[model samples]
Target: MNPKKPPVPVPLLMVIGIVAISFSSIFIKWSSAPVSVQGMYRLLFTSLLMLPFARPYSGAACALRLKDWLLLGASGVMLALHFLLWMGSLNYTSVASSTMIMALEPLFIMLGAYILYKERNSASAILGMAIAIFGVVFIGWGDIGLSAENLKGDMLSVGGTVAVAAHLLIGQKLVARMPSYLYSLIVFISAAIVFAVYNLVTSTPFFNYPAREWGIFVLLAVVPTVFGHILFNWLLQYASATTVSMNILGEPVGASILAFLLLGEQLSGLQWAGGVLVMAGLGVYLYSGRRKALKLQDSLPNAS
Candidate 1:
């Protein structure tokens, strides 16, 4: 008798992971700490939590060349910047605005893949991108009445989205040749170092945070940074990037609900409509891509 293979449902895990990550904004908003300090503590706790799984020295062994190290380091820097910018945007704009803008990351990723990696972009993907952008615009309009401050926040969120997209694309390359956990370890350590230096330069007191703030920081690190990212990386082993990317549309909806229940923040009817559009667009894109990929696979020659 053949041995049975344990079932691992990747899509379900990815959904749960992303929903957990969506709560990160709520935690950040709940804590009364400075954004820089919050970012520092978040990275510190995440690095520590990841240490057991990553085993830095052994992970470092997986990087066989200077180019690999450079790519990993770049991804880490981009990730740190993404956090910094996204968190900072929260200070200037509503969480709804920030999250909706950040939801544009899939569009950036699609564009980046096309430009950088020469990946082919189909009409369905382009239409999906446009629809997603419209949804973001709708959400943004509902957040702050199109004021300058809100516009600034929207731009910052967009910048963060670009940074994250770059990190993902580069990270995909690194993970393809090395262990995912190892690559993640290097990225986290690098992000920690960068944020530490940034905190030092800006005179941010890292050690003086209140206990409650520390608790929230630890929660953010453990829940979103570590577990969320680990599950996402794991899903990549079973699913395509497009499939995973489309699932990210769930984040804003989750965040909005948490913000409403926890922080008493309310979303407008327009914003809800925007969220629906985002989900619909992403659904169409992912479904179309999967069909295309399956057709291609079916047509490929197989070995006897």
Candidate 2:
């Protein structure tokens, strides 16, 4: 018989994730290194930190196959490409438009899962996702713009969102069996290696950055990269990709508050309303999922 899984506190971990990732944008703004440089260092530091506890790297006997490692590598490549494309859009599109487009990630995950794996959502879950998305529109309502010139950037943002969704989807399969830190270490190392090669090919210097910038890189690694993102990776063992993605929608709310405290970025009245809606939607949706899961568990004995 399979061992019973440990109870993971999904809500709490997701809250931690939101707060952790909220610092990501701030770190990027604070860094002076090129995007590739900053990304490489962030992964490098994160992978190093996670290395000590990572089961895959600990020389323990594991069930990992060649295909498994390749899937992890693919997931890492997709994540790297998501960053490159999303950031690349900034040159040609408004930040608001990009944010809005990137926000489509949850939908992509849901749809992709349905198509590729026949995963389905409950009525309440679908409702929750829609409401959360509406809240995002309110938060970004003022920033969104449309123009002929933004086509390429808009497309890139959409593509980036899809790539990120795929990353999450890939993780859903393996997160159950792999040690959390081990999975994160592998993916982080993979991304770092990819970025390093890309930077090297393009002649981007990897060293001698300003101390202030390096500090920001370390913060980025600790905050968003590890606590924020890898925490999500860890949480996947207990939640569906769609649900996890929904939880991530909380980031804009947390990020806005962080920005106000750290960078003096203020939220408009509509954005505040949007934040409320996001929290409410997530609460309702997650509650629904919990109820359903409990119901299924209760039925298992009778069914057997």
Which residue segments of model 2 deviate by more than 4 Å?
A: 1-8, 55-62, 87-100, 146-156
Cα displacement (Å) at residue 34, model 1: 2.0
Per-residue lDDT of candidate 2, residues 214-297 (tens digit):
898899899988887888887776677877787667877776676667767666888889878888888888998788778877
TM-score of model 1 relative to the true fold? Answer: 0.89
Q: Candidate 2: deviation at residue 243, Å?
A: 1.1
Per candidate, the number of residue pairs that clash is 0, 0
**Per-model CA lDDT versus the true structure:** 0.75, 0.77
* Residue range 38-65, candidate 1, lDDT tens digits: 8777877877876786555584565469
After superposing all C-alphas onto the true structure, candidate 2 shows an RMSD in angstroms of: 2.7
Name the 10 consecutive residues with the lowest summed lDDT in model 1: 1-10
